[model samples]
Target: MRLIIGGGTLAGKPQLLFIHGIGSARTSDVELREWSTSLANGARAAGHADLVSGLTQSWAAETRFANYSDLFYRADAQGAADGISEEELPLLLALLEEMTQELGHQAELAGDRRSGDIIDSARAQIRAAVEPDAVQGQGLFAVVRRAGNAVTTLLQLPGLRQASQWTSGVQLLPVLSQVGRYLARKEPDDAGQGLDVRIRERVLSGLDPSRPLIVISHSLGTVVAYEALHMYTGRVPLWITLGSPLAMGALVLQRLAPRPPQTPAGVERWLNFWDRDDIVVARPRLERWMEANALGVVPVTARADTHGLWTHTATKYLAHKDVAGPVAETLKNL
Candidate 1:
């Protein structure tokens, strides 16, 4: 796929690469426009009116989107449900359980008894569906279906309806299946390249060595961007990760490509933003586990809150002033 949105001329401007998380199936142009609009709104809120105009008008930076979500699907598959594999089932189940438990804890801390009860019920259902004796006769698909139905039931609750709005009718299982698949690092194509390798290649292909580059990645995309950055030789002025799962110890961190995860050598500065309400974010601070590169570059993390129910969307994170201010300032300098 073409990296440049709208195939516009760069005119020797700095490049801004956006790496999206899972469940993004739209075309590159649509994704680019939506992301640019959200980023522009955030810049405007941060009082960077000039930067806002540049972003909206497509003049300040050569914006590109690394679109790899489509790669998860096959030519004949209907959707993500068809992409799920038996090997990824265990990881998916583990994440679902972890998220349910965390949400239950949060609900309890807030003294929301009803929500807590609902989350607890969901957790129990997931566990029951995945138990060894239960799945032995039912098969992996049975576990997937039962666990997904549990999430659907939880989302359908009046208390969680708002939070589930982003997903609409989509099942949480399929949305999360993308994450499990990526972390599993299994080969999806006949070429023998692992899924993670293909995704990193897609991200790296978007980088232009001749221009000053800034990378903004969210959720699973953050994982892809991090690994790709290590393979890159060009300098990156700024790298931003939003709602990342990088700090998720067993489910993610330990399974990462590079050993003893550290800041990419080419990154001059890294900023990580997360929302407390975002279930996808296991830990908000990445600097705690990551080491500084030779250039002394390490992720400076901060909390950026979002209103209503769900806060994990890339646009929601980008719209926050805390996340956008640095981006605008960096663009202004670039």
Candidate 2:
């Protein structure tokens, strides 16, 4: 019941729930969740249009983004940490489905189908894999998380990924999925609606009345996470935002601080993480709410992403040192 909603990899899992960031050419998280996870020679690419940047076709993009996972090798540390859980399973499956479909376009190159037919054939296979009572506990289910996504969800497909790079918009489609594309289409406020309700149902309802809850979020996802707190329940143990743009906007800060969540225990704890140069975090002049809530805070700046590091590794890695590690250590001392 604990909730972690933020840009894909920033959500860190085991119990971490990924909320992919903005992108174009959207697909459904439910549908994009099913790509071949064991990895293959010609595994497709990932990301929404924005994530892909300048790619034009799925084939070129797939070849460019060819990571080792596509070849089904051993996993990195974080990816092997945990299974994709029931809640996140659907979204991952949908992304995989979308990627596989994109890869299906290759069938046309191989002469298995026609141009338009490629999209159709891939979609059909994706649909078949997702059908209820399909191959349960196999294929995608074989691995907790496809090595790529697990890495991206927490790492945002860091630069280290080798083999092939995401070559085009079409290739990024699989990773970004329809959900990301859909978010791209919606106004920030509009997208916040569904997330708000989900927060109440998943986050607010799931926490113990007596114990405080930890809410970890990042980037644009931080906006809704705070919105949910302001509009929904008032009980939280800690609210951590990594690569958060909210810290730079005082209006946003003041709005969130007024009536924090109400846990049975006492007041809440909010640990805000920021990368100073990050455009998302903005400047010191923008922070408005700190003076309002004014709790005992530990403010420290780590490395800067300089014009927004699309990847959020700094936030996660530091939080391990400053956020989670501290929290666990503090809990231990208590």
Candidate 3:
């Protein structure tokens, strides 16, 4: 991991920090390259040649990634034979239940009755798959396996699969497991510090109160960034969250660190982006749920559609002009 002792800024340039979501076990340098490339591509798509040039050049020197996924790594590789741990099971179930409900609601909004039926059927299948008596003869592992298969089956459904672009239950399970481990706040590293605390510390370390900072976070990282900003004394000119689950009431919203959720005092403006087909997103509009902070900073939520099958990917969201345009504009003004 690259340490930013004096803050992320280089010379007088502003700092841009990227906080990634779940399943990012790769090195920070590798992720920085990938994320920077995506952001540059996005700026190009937004017709900001200057921003693209800057990102491709010295802007990288000023950028930092809050890499915390290393803390969640296990001796057994992800998606291994061990399956989801008992501690992570409840969180996964809660997330899946909430996802199904949101999917049904989205289908209704789109007037897609067939999709709604498919979601309802999948919900029933999941409920039955996890029932104690359903797998009485089998062990707990059997129950988890069946539940995972059911969720995968739902994703593979003809319509839903095409819409979501995510077909592997194997891939989804690990992502949910990591997210669960963080939100459950029960797991600790070898040092005895809570995983949540450690993860937030990683984020806080990248924050430099001395510079004009812009934070761009995705998925579960949004949760970490949100909490870290609350604890930070610096001010952020812009904050962006993509495909976040913060609106997943029971599983995420209620479990946030601060008592009642509000825009972090340090943030001046917040932009939240979501795709209707992104299964990770429960509700697209965060402004409706999170209260404005003392700075009167409330999230301005917008839809940035990525028609790809898997709209949840950070790169996919970054590539959208609607999403990238704002970042470029903010940077230009800064």
Cα lDDT of candidate 1 equals: 0.79
Error of 3 at 98 (Å): 0.5
lDDT of 3 by residue, 1-334 (tens): 1223344535446678889997647698888777878888888888986677577553533778789988887675454434576557767777888888888898899998877887888788678755756445665577677667767766754434864434567557767777778887866768888889998998878556877788899999899888888898876888999999998887899888796889998899899998887777787788888988998989999888877776777888888887778778877776
Candidate 3, which ten residues in sequence have the lowest lDDT sum? 1-10
Residue 98 of model 2 has an lDDT of 37
Q: Give the Å shift of residue 258 in candidate 1.
A: 0.7
Kindly report which residue pairs in candidate 1 clash with one another. Answer: none
lDDT of predicted model 2: 0.35
Q: How do these models rank on TM-score, best leading?
A: 3, 1, 2
Of the two candidates 1 and 2, the one with more favorable TM-score, higher being better, is: 1
Give the number of the best model, judged by TM-score: 3
Model 1 over residues 242-305: C-alpha lDDT tens digits?
9898977788888887879999998999999987677677766899989999999889988887
Give the winner by lDDT.
1
True-vs-predicted CA distance for residue 35, candidate 2, Å:
21
